[model samples]
Target: MTERIGIVGGGIVGIAIARALTARGVGEVTVLEKERRLAAHQTGHNSGVVHAGLYYAPGSLKAQLCAAGRVLIREFCQEKGLPYREVGKLVVAVDDTELPALAEIERRSIANKVPRLARIDDPAHLRDIEPHVAGVAAVHSPETAVVDYASITEAMAQDVRAAGGTILLGHGVTEITVDGDTVRVATDASEHEFTRLVVCAGLQSDIVAKLVGADPSPKILPFRGEYWALSPDRTDLVSGMIYPVPDPRFPFLGVHFTRGVYDDVHVGPNAVPALAREGYGWLTISPKDTWESLRWPGAWPLAKRHWRMGVDEISASLVKRLYFGKARRFVPELRMADLEAKTASGVRAQAWGRDGSLLDDFAVDRIGPVTVLRNAPSPAATSSIAIAEHVLQHHLDLAAT
Candidate 1:
C-alpha cells in the first residue's frame, strides 16, 4: 500500500485510476499531466455523451466496460452534484437500403443489454420521440445520456487529492526507464520513480508506448473529427441525440446530432486524417507527424481501403453544402444556414496495425511493471472508470475492490 504509483496523462481515465488507487489505499499515487491542466486533449474535445453500449460487439471490452461505466459515471455525477442528463438517443434508418444496418445495431444493442432498448418501425412512433426526425425505422436507446466530461474529470482529480494522491500538472513525460520491478519517468521539470506505472496518454498513446520499449506495430493514426454547431434558435430541431447507422467498416460513429448537457445541439463530426496529433483545423500541420503517418506500412493499405470515404469526408470538410447535405438526411427541415459554423474539432487517436486494420475494441499492453492503453476511442470517456478498474485488475494484477 505504501508503494509509489505513477500515472501518465491527467485525462478522466488516468484520474479515475488514481482515485481508485488512493481510495482503496493501494499506493502512494501521483498523476503527471503534460498540460498545465487536466482533460486538455481528447477528453476536453469530445462530445460529452455518456453512451448506452449500443454499437459495440457483444462480449467485447467496449460493450462490457461501457455498460458498467455508464452507471458509475451517472452515480459519480450525482455524488459530486455534476450535470448529467439522460436526453436519450435514436439511431434512424432513412430508407429501406439502411434497414439492414439498423437491424444490426438493434441486434448489438440487445446483445449488449443496453438499458431500455426499443425498435420503432412506424414513422409516427419515431416522430413521437423526435418530431423533426424522418426515418422509416430506428433503434432507440432511452438511457443514452450526456454530461460535461471535463468537469467530471476535475471532480475525479479532487477525489484523488482528497485521498492523498499527488497530481502534478505541466509534467509531460519525456522518458521512461524500466529496471527490475521499478519504473522511472522523466519530465522536463522533474523526475520520479514508481513501483507501478499506468499510461493513459490518449492521443499520444502509441508515442508513449515506444518510450517504454513496447512494440510499434500498433501506431496511432490521428483522425480529426470536425463538428458544426446548430444555430441556437434552431437547436430545437433535435430533441435529444439523433444518429445514423454507423458504417461498421470503420470504428467512428458518423455525422449526427447531439443536444449537449447544456442544451446546445451540435451536428457533424465527420472523420478526416489529421496532419498533427493535436491539430484542430486544416491550417495547423506538423510535418514530422504527417511524415511518420505517411511512412507507416499501414498508411498505403488503409488509404486504398478507404479512399472513397476519405474523399467524401474530406469534401464534406471543405464544402459546407456537402456537410449540410449529410446532416439533413434525418432531419429534412435542416437548412444549409442552420449549420452555424465549425464549432469544435477533436482528433481521434485511432490505433492501426501494420496490416492496416483499425482496432475496434479497447487495447492494452504490458511491459514489466508498466501498463499502457493503446487504443481508446469514442466510448473511452464513457468507460473511463471501468477501464481504470479493468487495467488495475488485469494488466497490473491489482484487484480494484
Candidate 2:
C-alpha cells in the first residue's frame, strides 16, 4: 500500500518537497497552505538573490546544499524558461578594519569551492566591477544571481500537480496528532490524515511544532527586514548586487544595494526585532506574538547581550537618514534623496536557543512520521531543491524505510 503524505506550508521548501515526493512516486502528496496563494510570506518577500555558497562555513549543510542548489536552480530556470540572470555580487570592505572579516569570508568561499570567486583589492578594479561602489576591497562572486523565487515556487507547485499531488490553499494547520501509525493534521477548515507529515511553517514553525508535541526550546524570533527602492533614475547606480562584509557577531548580511531581476534597485533590509511574528511595519502589532517572544526564557538574556545592536537596528528602522547612511558607506553616490518609496518588507523566521544563542544552521526535527523544519532562513530559498532531497534521504529515510 502506498503511504499518504501531507505537507504543511505552501512556501518554496514545502512545495519543493511535495514536488520531490510526487516525482519519486513516494505517495499521495497534499500541500496545505494557510494563505490564498503560495509563497505569500517569506518566500514571496525575499530579495530574490540566488546565494553562492560564499558566507556559509565549510562542510556545513548550508555550504553543501547552497552550492548544489545554485546549480539545480540555474538548470531548473533554464529548463522552465524562467528569468535567471548572473548579475554577480560584491562583498565589499569599506576600510582596512573590515578586510580581516572579508579575508575570512574569502577563505570560507574557497573552502566551499564557490565557482569563479575572485578577490579585488585595487580600488581601480573595484570601480571597474561596481563603478559607483566606494569599497576599498571586495570579493566578487560572478556566479551569484537573482530570480523570482515566487515564480519558482509556483512552477514547483505545477510539477507537484502534474505528478498527481494536491495543493489546498487557505488551510491553516492548527494541530497535529498521532494515532498509532497514522498522523492526523487539523487545519482551521478541515483535518487531513496521512502516513507522514512535514511542517515547513516559516514564521510559525515553533507554534506548529508544539502542536505535534515537539520541543519549543529553539523558539522563532521574527526579525523584520525593511527595504527602500531606488528611484527609477537612480537604479543605474547599481549594476548588480553589492553587499557589506557581514559582522561576525550577527547573522544578518547588513544593508546593501541589489538590482532586482526586473531591473529595479533596492537598498536596506535592516534587521530589527519585529513587534510580531508577521509584523512588517511598526503599526502591525500582534499582542499574542509579542507576548510569546518576550515571555520566552531566552528572550531576556538574548536582548541583554545584543541590546546595543538591537537599539541601532530599531533606530535605523525609524530614521531614514541613518538607514540610508549605512548603504552610503559603500555606495558613496547614494543620497537620501535617491531612496524612492518603501517596498514590501520580509520577516526572517530566525530560531534562537534557550541559552541565548542563535541557531545558525538548518534544523530538522523528526518526531515519528512528522518532520519539522525548525530553522531555515536566508539561503533556504536557494537551497530549496537540495533541502528537499536532504529531507528525503536523511529526515524521512525513504530508501531505508
Candidate 3:
C-alpha cells in the first residue's frame, strides 16, 4: 500500500523532500503552495550563494548538512544542466581586531572539513584573489558557489511531478489536524488527507506549526534583509563574493558583496526588524503581525538585549549612504553612487525562545505524524537535500524501514 504524504510550503526544502520521498518510492507526495508560483518568498529572494560550511559550529547539524548539501546540490545542478558557478568566496578581515574572529572561522572551517579551504595572510596574495577587496587577511573558500535557487526549486517540482506527485499552487494551508493514523490538512480552497504531513511554511512556520498543536514557544520573528544591486559600471569592481568576518555578537552574516550566477554583483542585505511576517518593503505593514511579535514573551527580552543593534539597522535601512558605508568596509572603491537601486528583499523567519535567545541552528519538531520546520534560515536552501535525508532518518523515522 502506498503511504500518502502531504507537504506544506513550496520552498526548496519542502520540494526537495517531496523529490527525495518520491525517488525512494516512500509514498504519494503532494506539495501545497500558498502562492501562485513556487519559491515566491525566501527561496526566491535569497542572495543565492551556496554556503561552504564556514560559520557553523563543529558537530552541529548545520555544519554536517551544509557540507554534504553543497556537494549534493552541485551534482544535482550538473545533472539538470542548471546554472551553477564556482565563483568562490573570501571572508576578509580588515583589521587586527577582526583577525581573531577570522582565525576562529578558519578553525571552524577546518573542523567542518570544507574542501579547498585556504587561509591567506599576505596582503599581496589576498589582493590577487580579489583585487578591489582590501583586507589584512582572508579565508578563501573556492568551492563556495552560486546558483539560481528558484530555478532549482522548479526543477525539483518537475522531478516530483515526473515521479507521480501532485503540486497544488495557491493552496494556502490554514489548519492541520491529526486523527489517529491519518492527518488532514485544511487550506483556503479545500482539504487534504494523508498518512504524514510536513510543514515547511517559511515565514508562517510558527502559525502553521501551532495549527497542528505544536509548541509555540520559539516564535518566528521576521527580519527583512534588503539588497542593493551594483551599478553596471561598478559590477566589474567585484570578481566574486567578498564577505566580512561576521560579528560573533549577531547571527546575521553582516553586509557583503555577492556575484550572482549571471555575473552581476550585489551588495548589502542589511537585517532589520520587519513589521510583518511578509513585510518586503518599508511601506508594507501588518498590524496583527506586529502585535503578535510585540506580544510574544520573548519579544520584550530580545528587544532589551538587541535594541542598540536594532536602532543601527533601522538607521542603515532608512539611509542608503549608511548602508553603503557598511559594505564599503571590504571594498573601499564602493561609493554611495555605486548603490544604484534597491533589489528584491527577503524576510528571514528567525526563531526566538521565551528566554530571549535566538535559535542559531536548524530546528524541526515532530508531533505525531506532523513534522514542523521551526527555524530554517540561511543554508536551508543549500542544505535542502541533506535536510531531507536527516528529516527522513531522524524526525520522520522512515529511513530504517
Give candidate 3 regions above 4 Å deviation.
none
Could you tell me how far off, in angstroms, the CA of residue 228 lies in candidate 2 after the best superposition? 0.3
Estimate TM-scores for all models.
0.99, 0.99, 0.98
Please list the C-alpha lDDT of all candidates, in the order they appear.
0.93, 0.92, 0.92
lDDT for 189 in candidate 2 is 94
- TM-score, model 3 to reference: 0.98
- Lowest-lDDT window of 10 residues in candidate 2? 392-401
Error of 3 at 128 (Å): 0.2
Tens-digit per-residue lDDT, 1-401, candidate 3: 56899999999999999999988888788999999999999999999999999999999999999999999999999999999999999999999999999999999999999889999999899889999988899999998999999999999999999999999999999878899979998899889899999999999999999998888878899999999999988898888899999989888998899999988889878899899888899899999999999989898988898899999989999998889889888888888999989987999988999888999999999899899999999989999999999888888767855
- The TM-score obtained by model 1 is 0.99
Which parts of model 1 are misplaced by more than 4 Å? none
**Cα lDDT for residue 401, candidate 1:** 41
Q: Pick the candidate with the highest lDDT.
A: 1
lDDT digits (tens) for residues 126-164 of candidate 2: 889899988789999998999999999999999999999
Across residues 1-401, which tens digit of lDDT does each residue of candidate 1 receive? 46789999999889999998898888799999999999999999998999999999999999999999999999999999999999999999999999999989999999999999999999999999999999999999999999999999999999999999999999999999999988999998899989989999998999999999999979999999999999999998999999999998888899999999999999968999999999999999999999999999999999999999999999999999999999999999999999998999999888999989888889999889999999998799999999988987888777734
Q: Could you tell me which residue pairs clash in candidate 2?
A: none
Cα distance off (Å), candidate 3, residue 251: 0.7
